[model samples]
Target: MNGIRAFGATPSDLALDPFDEGTSSYSKAKDTSPIARLQERIDRGETKLSHDAQFGYLLSLMEELGVSTHSQLLVFSKTSLQRERITPKTPRALYFNDDVYLGFIPGAPFIEVSGMDSKLGGVFYSIDQGKTGRPRFVRTDQCLECHTSTKTLGVPGPLVRSFITDADGVVDMASGTSLVNHRTPLSERWGGWYVTGTHGAQTHRGNLSGREAFALHEKEPNHLGNQMDLRRFFDVSRYPAATSDIVALMTLEHQAHMQNFLTRLNQDSTSALRQFGHLNMKK
Candidate 1:
């Protein structure tokens, strides 16, 4: 099989831009939020934490198989996010599709599969090689098929019912109060609920309407305002990858998936051959 390097004559030969929306910020204050924090981490660092020795080992195996880069892999997690923390029990690595990668549009929620666990948090992915385009949100229904079914893994799936907590950290589903007891309406809890009004009587205008609503929502006392706008949150032009690091990252990710596929095939063949031998003896 041809390696990515083979497909492209040289790394510099690849036609790509390095300016990733995920890495740049127009408003430094906006980028200080939790979602942006996580994005920064994911963009600049490796996925494994120091405590994740086993996960690191797995990453090594992946790297050996050519799954070491950023473009080829899409990460998903079955955990909710908070303004400060992410608790993930079922983190999955999948292949990136064109739609999923570049789907973060101007009006979308910047939803991220990795951040689905928390109402306050969202996820976004960059599709354009340089991360110049908008980041799109991942919808709740889109995740329900695999996340809602415990039969597949026996763990609680992705679908979760969350309520705002009061200052005492008491969840008041009736009033939509959160740990701070800000008296936030249930209608505005998660981005999805806030956008769709599934949790409360309030109906959020999709995209364009949402933007108009956000301007109004920001004026309300105690509202943190909508922090999901990439343009408002990031400086889209200045990133370390602005020099073609994104292309490199995507190239690396693609190589990793290819290697993983080949590795899986080899393992399958070995298993099949063993099965055949066992059947012959039994016969």
Candidate 2:
């Protein structure tokens, strides 16, 4: 797993394992990510993870990850590993803390997680909800397909996108999309997400469903904006939270880019310092 994690899909990608001896080895180093630490505790018999009848490891995982249930954001776009399971009727729920992010779909077998390492940019894993007695987080690189691209500033990092989504929860890629962040305009954010709040007359692309509704948005911007309830679109009772807080969504947008920039800084500085030291040693 360590060796596989060291190498990325493309040659131009940085060797996360620390190619030169001078730099710290990210894969081989003391992995201090939240999930990794929790795994260590489990291995040492210090603690155990629990499961639930309905939410599976969701409740337990959030406790272990130290994220608030209040931080949940609901995204309905077909933009995840379980695309078939996600629709406007069943939007995927996302929760994040400063360093960790947990993604869940109701009744799904596993909970997707992305966490930050003090050194390694982002680590991806999934906890099997079915494993009752001894659930373990299994690391996977499948997330790198989208996470390590230009959107993440060429490093393994967070991804937040807003785009036009039709009724079936399909994102219209050709219509253009914004990789959301603090710089994102109010009008362009939360296209595929369910934002439940009253933002006064400040219009956004949230809560509007179907092509017709979107067409209406082009004419009347706030027609579907400032939605305080989501029961009409889907059974809000089915999700962890009845409402997706606009403040939480806004915070997520800012932090996503911040995490990417922080990761890029960590990578670049480490490499540069290592090379400088290497050159000095030869002198």
Tens-digit lDDT track of model 2 for 103-171: 998977788998888677788888886756778888887877787766776667789888788898898
In candidate 1, what are the lDDT values of residues 178-254, reduced to their tens digit?
A: 21111223334332121111213233211111234345544652243332322332232321111112233234334
**Number of the top lDDT candidate:** 2
Q: Where is the poorest 10-residue window by lDDT in model 1?
A: 83-92
Model 1: CA > 4 A from native:
1-246, 277-283
Model 2: pairs clashing at backbone N, Cα or C within 3 Å: none
Model 2 misplacement above 4 A: 1-30, 278-283
TM-score of each: 0.20, 0.87
Error of 1 at 195 (Å): 26
Instruction: Tell me each candidate's RMSD, in Å, in order.
Output: 20.5, 5.4
